[model samples]
Structure formats: C-alpha cells, structure tokens
Target: MQGLQQFFTNISQFFEFLVVYYSIILGFCALISVLVLGIIMFLRKTVLADRVFAKAASWGLLILCLFCGKLKLIFETKAGWYTLGRWDLLCAHRIVSIIYIVGIFIFAAYFIYRRRRLHKFVKGLDKATTCSFDNEIRKYPGTISPFCIGCIHPIIVIPEKLDVQNALIVIKHEETHIKLGHLWIIAGYDMVRCLLWPNVFLHIAAKYIKRDLEDVCDAVTMQMNGIDPFDYGESLLANAKEIMLSRKNMKCEEGFLFAWDDNYKVLNKRIHRILERNGYDRKVVLAGGILFIMALIASIFGIKCFSYKRNNPLDISGIYSMTKMDTVVQDTEEKIVTGYDGDYIYIDGAALKEAYPDAEIEEQPLFVFVGGYYKIPGVGGGGGWGEFSASDVKDGVFRIENHDDIDVWNWMIMWL
Candidate 1:
C-alpha cells in the first residue's frame, strides 16, 4: 500500500507539473489524443492483419499525452507560458496538488476494492475439464463468457456451456487475442481512462481501440484453422448476446478484455467485416507500421514542444526593490523604475539619458526578460554593475544563490 501510495504521489506530482508549467498544453492534450484516435479509426481496416502495429500506435499516443510535460524538459524548447506558479498562486498549486492527491487516493481505494473482489471471483473458477487447451486456461462456472486477462501469464477462461464447434471457435478467438498482445493493449486503454478520467473523447476512443483489437483477433482467428467465416460471424453475434445478458448480472470490469463486446454499432461492424473476409497485404501493413512510427517520431520532433522563443519573456514591468544587498552601495531603500530598450534592460531614466548624451536612447519600462544582461546603476546589491539575469528575480525579489558565486561576480564587476 505504501508503494502504491508513492506511485500515485508521483503521478500527482506529474499532474501538478503540467498545471504549473504547461496548462495550455494540458488542455489541448485531449484534443490531440482524439485527433490521433480518429486517424487510427480511419486506417484500421487497411492494416487489420498486423496486430502489433495497432497496439504500437495506440501505445504511442497514450505515452505522448502522459509525458508531454516531461517532453518540454527533454526537448530543447522549454515551457515558457506558465499559467500559474507565481508567488501568490504557488501556494494555490500546492493546494491543487493535495486535492488531486485525494482524488487519486479515492480512486486507488476503489480500484483496489474492485481488484480484490475480482481476485476472489476469479479464484472460484474451478478448473472444469471441458476444454483441453492448456494449463494456463482456467474454466469458470461464472456467467461471463471466455475472456483474456493478464499480460505476463494470460488466462483464457471458458464458461460452462456451448457446442463443441462454437466452443473451439471461442477458444481460438481468445487464443488469438493472447498471441496478438491485445490484453496488454486494453490495459493501456484502461490506464488512459484511469489517469485522465476527465477526457470524454478518450473514453470514446477506448471503445474504438477495443473494437479494433477485436477486429485484429477476428482477422487472425479465421486464418488459424479452417473455420467458416459465416460460422465465425454467427459465433461472434451469439457470444456478444451471451456477454450482454451476462453483463446485466456480472460484467468483466477492471482488468480483463472481453473476447466479444456488446456495443451494437461496433458489433455490427465486426460481423460485417468478418463476412467480407478481406485479405491484408504485407507491404500495406509494413507501410502502415512505418506511418505510425513516423507519427510517434513527429510528436517528439514536432508537436511535443509547446513553448516558443521569447527574447523578453518575463513581464516584470513594475517597480522593484533591492531585496539582497551583499556589497557596499548607496540609495538602498529606493524603489527603482526599471525599463528596457527592446531586449537591453536598463535602470535610472536620468542616468540613461545622461549616458546617451545625444538623447537618442529613450527610457522604456524594464522588460525583465530572460537572458538579458545589463548594467543596473544605483543597484544596492552591488558597488558597480551586477551581472544578473532578470530570470533570477522572482516576484520582484532578486534571490541570492550561492554566496561564493556572488563573491566572484562582485569581484569581476568591480574591475569593469
């Protein structure tokens, strides 16, 4: 439980990181997810035979959404537009962190309860000697028909009744799911739903991704043995009906992937596709796989960076007091009206006007931007000029970092 608590805490921290640094990107992440899912929906049929490609594409999108904030850190373009985390709202961000931590804890408890209950329910499936498939296969007397569960040691649970032919077809369908790695793929979808529960489009995409997984299973199942496509379609409709009726009483929730779904629309599509029984070309599947891979790469090199280059990023246009004074100087109590000439930050309008002599350089508000180095006259913190980026000033206070570095800076500035 403590380890799980730590897991959720880390997740909560990632959540706060996005809110603090990339709030706009956080809002648009959902839209990006929906757009890619739509792309997958369109091209699902062309590459129906290759199950790995579908799963890879789905995982790529999920990873991109979850780690977009981190991407800014990894990529060269750092997050510039921080919506919050100012001195005032920094405290509020901590509060928001606590709130979502509570949310995560509540969901964690609820998921734990469901999992424990599911474990007890699964444990009751007394290995009935109906299907002689394998040792991993567990026979359940429960109403929920055959479904595949687990990533490592995937179990195919066959329920009590069904004709021999239909039963074998059902086993083949689920077996195809296991071999095609659909169980882990569904787990990916569930993670997306669990972490980003607010996104309605993602939940809708889950239904489609799950349907595509089923389609892959169907495509592979027909090729394994000489089962008639019509028979396979009939079995799908029958199993879907059984699962629908069974779901009314007991449904496969939490961890398992139902072999057949009950959605009428998706179910109809699956049945029709099975009737068509089209063949997929190796070159097309290969091309589609490359497309998904390129899309993932594009996300890294393209859409992942949400920040733009800014010469004068920070908007510290108000009066500022010298918060730190390490050197001997006068006028320490004066609040300097800072200004900038484009990217060149300067202070003391009269002093600047005196320096120019020609009066060509006008005094603009000190645009406390990033990466701007300027000679701040009459700054109480130093004797002559202090070489400090305006980025160091938070909430109009220049924080003293590393007293040793300050000593070196003061010595060097005195020479200039």
Candidate 2:
C-alpha cells in the first residue's frame, strides 16, 4: 500500500513537472511567433499584418509575464518556497501538458530498449578469466565482468576461477544490486534526465539518485557478509587484468561478459567509492527537494498574475459586426458596411440603445484572448453593449468584447 501511494505520488509529481515544462515550451514558441509577426508587420505595412502582430504580441507578452511570475513563486528562497508539501507541479496548462508527458513515456521506452541491447551485447563478451561459471557459461574475449546489464534482470558473469572466499564477497555485492533493484531506479532517473534535457533540477536529481543507489548497495553488501570490504575489493583487482578485444576468442565470446577495451578506470572508481563511503547528508537532500517543488508552484500562480482578464462570454449577446478594410466590407445585416475585409460581428446597437435610453452610443474595438474572453478598449460600464465601428477597431477580427454568449462567439474565420 505504501509502495502504491509512493508510485501515485511520483506520477503526480512527474505530471506537474510536465505541465510546467510544456507551458514554458509553448510560451517560448508564442514569443517567437509574436516577434516574427511584429517584424513582418513592420516590413509589410499592411493593416492585417499589423493587427495579427498586435494580437500575437499581446499573447506572447502575457505568457512571458506569467512565466516570470511563476518563476518567482516557485523559487523564492526568501519565502521558504513551501506550498504545504505539494511537489510544485505546474497546474497551469492542461492539453499541451498531457501531450508533453505522453511524449516522455515514448522517448523513455526507446532509450531503455537501445541501452539494454547495447549492455546485453557488451556483457556477453566480458569474461573476467578463462574459467566459466557453469558448463553453459562460455569463456569470452574480455577481462571485465558484465554485471551492469539490464535494469530488470542484470546478469553479472563472474569468472569461475576465484576462491570461495572471494566468490562469496562478489556474490554478496551483486546480490545487493539485485535485491535493491538499483538498476531499474537508475534507468528511470536517466529517462527523466533525457526528457527534461537541459534542466538543472533533473541533473541534480540524477546525481543524487545515482550516488544513493551505489551507497545503499555498498552498505547492503557489507551487512550480508563477514569478509572485510577492502579485501573483497582487492580480490576484484588482483584476478582482473585489463584486456581489450581478445582476437583468439572473439567469435565465441560474442554474447559474453567482457571488457570492450583495456580501460580499468571504471572498476578503479567503483573500488574507491566503496572505500570512501563516509558521508551522505540528509539535510542537503531535503533542502534540494523542497526547492525543486517550490519553483514549480511559483510558476503557476505567476502565469495567472500576468494574464490579462477579459469579459466572460456570458455578458454580451447581440449581432456583432467585423470588417477588414474599406475595400472589403460586410456587416451582420447582410449589412455590408462597405470596404472592410476579414471578419466582423454586428451587434444590435439600436436595441442596446433602446434598453438603456440614456446610455451613450459609443464605438469600441474588441480583442479576444485564448480562454474565451473578449476585451473592449475604452469601455467603462457594467452592462452596456455600445455601437462599435469597423474604423474604431484596431484589429481585423472584431468580437463583441463584452459577452458570455457561446453561440455568438462560435463563428471563426480567416480575414484573408
């Protein structure tokens, strides 16, 4: 049950990261689009181009603003970046985030498959000595053990020539890896790193996960045996002489455990790390995790802070008119206003005036945001839809910026 709970928690945290990361990605793309549109508009001098650039600019800037706000909230060290232990999952965007997460799982599967295949092929050729573990075990070409193969079922082929004393210690060490399931854990961490590519947090997470796995395995191996850890490590070095590709047994050792090259550096480091296992600070880990989560939460609220609020679709309901230019014109009446192109909404301005007789008839241009909200420039009232002119509108696509009617907002078209 505890394991199940942890699994769910991890999935939740991973999803949150994906959501925020995707938002960042989208925000970046929107920003670039806006900048490009802006440049195109400036160069073209067309009203349509200008309008498109303006809309794109507004969206891009809003996204960037939100990103900045979230960054502060999530990573604010001054406030002790804690949000009730909720791992900072960017609870902002929904659809894009789901897409990002699905992509991660696909990439991880591919990466694991490739790495596992390489490790398996390499392992088959990694023979430590002439003697085989069993009659079925073949003597291969290399002088290193191929114990670091699969995350699920790693087969560490030790040479059968070692004394029982040495053999027992080696078995205990390998047993630690199998029992703890460290390889699987490492493989998972590697996937996370690959998915998030340049993220510093993922890098830190990978480091700790790797280091802890090794340290824990070392402790487990020592606890299982009475042999001195140093002696077991020495035996590993004594019986092993680094050998590159052995021409004599090359074909026979194709799938055996052997060293790919004559480099004994990796084995040397393992021995050193085992000997120098004196420190593992829990506080550092706790602090790191806390910071990671805090940063994620800050990003969500920060986005909200930067977002521009527009009127809900429920507020305004009338035939709104939209027009592009004087040359191409069409109003909601079959109401071709003349010369305006693109699209327009024609609201019942006459009816609006009848509802509020004293209300001033004014022309307001409309702007629409991503979340179905519309903004009317220079309008200051609670419940009045004024007469809006195509000339007054700055953009080609005009929406009746004050309304909550979904039916009215459903019509979507391109101006060109």
Candidate 3:
C-alpha cells in the first residue's frame, strides 16, 4: 500500500509539472508545424515535398514535445522562464490536468471495448483470400467504407456490396496503410490526444498528421501499383458516397478507422494533389527554402525564450525560530536549520536534498528558497519559497514575510 501510494504521489507531481509547462512546448510545436506547412503550400509545385514535409513536421514536432515533457519530468522543473503566479491560472491548471487524466482513462476503456467488439465482428465474418497479397481480408456486412484496423496484426475490411475493382483498390489502399505502419502512427496520435486533451492546437495538428498519413499511403499505392490517379479518385468518391448513405441507416462506433479521405475537404485536397503532380518553380522553391530555414531558427529561439531558469540566489544559513499564524490561537514557534551545499540548499537537515538530487536552486536577495513545500509544526505548508528582506531583520530577528506565497510568519536566528 505504501509503495502504491508513493507511485501515485510521483505521478501527481509529474502531472503538475506538465500542466505548468506544456503551453511552452505546445506553442513551439504549433508554430514550427504551421510555418513548415505554409512554406510547403507556397512552394506549390512540390506535391511530394508537401506530403513528405507535412508528415515530418507534424510527427517531428509531436515527438519533440513528448521528449521535452519527459525531460521536464526527469528534471522536476517547469520549462518556461516565467511562472504565472495568478491563483486563477493555478486553479485552471489543476482542473485541466484532472480532466485530462480522467479523459485518458475513459478513452482507454472505450478503446478497449471497441477493439473487443471489432475482434468479435471479425471473428464472425467470412475471411477470403481474394487479393494477391497474403493479408487477412474480411467482408463487413454494413455500409461502412473500407478501412484498415489493428496495429500489431492489421486486417483489411471492406463492405460486402462493393464491386471487384473498387474492392481491389480499397484493399490496396488499406494494405498500403498497414505496410507503411500508419496504424501505429494513429495509435500513437490517439495516446497523445488523450494526454493533451485540452490543447486545441494539438488536436488541429493531429488532423493534419492523419491527413498526411492518408496522402502518403495514396501516393505510395498509386506509384507501386501503376494505378491511374483519376481512377483512384473515382474509387474514393464512390466509397465516400457509400459511407454517407450507410451512415443514414446506422451509427458508426468510435474507434481507430484509417478511412481514406475521412473529411470532405481533406478528400478534395488529396484528389487535387493526385490530379496535379506538377513541379514547382525553382525561384519559389528557393524562397521557401530560405523561409523554412528562418522558421527553424525562430523555433529554436522561441523555445529558449520561454524556457524556465532559476536566476535568483540568496545567502541563507543558520538555525532559526519559525512562527506560524492562526485565527483563533496565538502564533507558534519552531526551530529549523537551513544550510547551503553545492546546488541544493538543505533545510531542517538534508532529506529534501537527498530526495531531489537534481533540484535547481536559486537565491533571491530578499527571499529564502524553501524549495517546494515545507511543513512548519502547528503552521501551514505551501508549494513556494518564503520571502524576506534585510530591513525585515532587526536585533538578530529575521522576519520571514511570506512563506510559500502565503502571508505567515517571522523567524529569529537561534544558532549558526
């Protein structure tokens, strides 16, 4: 029970850090992805470049954000330089983190339930060996469009009434998704979505990532099979029509569906790209390349600008008498010792220093760093350091104005 409690405590702390610092990480990712997409779109003639670059930028930024989050967790420090000390912001962070964690649990349950249903459905269906590729192809009875499902052992499913040629194309497309490991990408994205449930920017980025994955699969399928782009577009349109008609009669369950051109606008964009496989002007490419480089540099600068730092340092050492305020009772006193050693300032012995070995310490001239929260007997404990000034000290008595951002008490030196 103690071990489990400790595990949860650690997890809670990590989530708190994420809630405090995620904005900076996500802002950088969003900025970089948007700039990269905009530059690619402007270049115009590079369809392949657009597809490749979009995939890279979207996935790359997400991975980078996850990496940054892990680093923050390991370091136990918020990444942004500025801490928004507003009470409302702190409350919001706590609330949002709670919601996100709950949402992940709910999503996981739903996902597992849906996957079980899908497996049962697959089991009942008649598996056929119609395609040249040795993949499990199952005919689904409903009017749903063809989609590839499952990550580890992917299976292609097609509607029963679809014609032979279109079925082949659908199978080919889904096989392309499976072959290129798009299902795993989508699974990874879903997990990210769950983690960043409150971030609208990340949701938008996810849509773009999904769209690029589909486009890449389409491009690869056409090239590998020597199929006509026009034909593929027609097949997609027919599939979309069938799916729309089917949806009128029944509701589709929520799960991973690698449906080709899930959104109409995205479908249109895919069709346009397929129809126009032209090259861009060299001058435009050159201009875009320069802009891309500039965006990269700007992204780096933005990350550094927002990153957190402990710049303030204070010289604090000695045994002091602490005072605590109470509404009904009188103030209370307790003896505490503070000592500075290397990067960490040990308080009331060295337990904190031992626990958080990599803790960043900064000394502000007038404030004594309490690290995180500290409990003063008969007083209260909060999550920030305490503040005091030179003038606050008189006759060997140092008044600790505010501890952990709370208006509390004073301390007098008892021993060195």
- Expressed as tens digits, the lDDT of each residue in 1-416 for candidate 3 is 99899778866654454443444333333333444445544443355456443443435345434433212222233532233122124334456545545666776777678777877777677775567465788887667767767887788888888899998888889998888778887888777665545545555656666667777777778877778888988998888877666555444441125333356776777788777754334465458657766776676556545433222122222221222121111111222323333333323313322332222231223334443221111111222344433233333223343333322221111010
Candidates 1 and 2 compared: the better one by lDDT is 1
**Runs with alpha carbons beyond 4 Å of true place in candidate 3:** 1-57, 69-100, 132-134, 248-265, 278-318, 322-416
lDDT by residue for model 2 over 1-416, one digit each (tens)? 99899778866754564355444443333333344334433443444222221222221222232233223333345342453112233324466556555666666787768786766565555444433232122233334453544655455555545556665566566666766666665675565445543334444434434434555566556645555667856765664432333324554254342344324665676577556644334466448546645655675566655432333222323323233212122133322221121333343334434433322332433322112232211111232333454344432223443332233112210000
Clashes of each: 3, 50, 9
Pick out the ten consecutive residues of candidate 3 with the lowest summed lDDT.
Answer: 407-416
| Candidate 1 Cα outliers beyond 4 Å, as residue runs | 1-62, 70-94, 108-113, 130-135, 241-265, 303-416
Residue pairs with colliding backbones in model 1 are 338-366, 339-365, 339-366
- Model 2, position 175: C-alpha lDDT score: 63
A best-first ranking of the candidates according to their lDDT comes to: 3, 1, 2
Q: What is the Cα-based TM-score of model 2? A: 0.40
The models' CA-based lDDT, in order, is 0.52, 0.43, 0.53
TM-score of each: 0.58, 0.40, 0.55
Which consecutive 10 residues in model 2 have the weakest lDDT in total?
407-416
Comparison by lDDT, 1 against 3, better one: 3
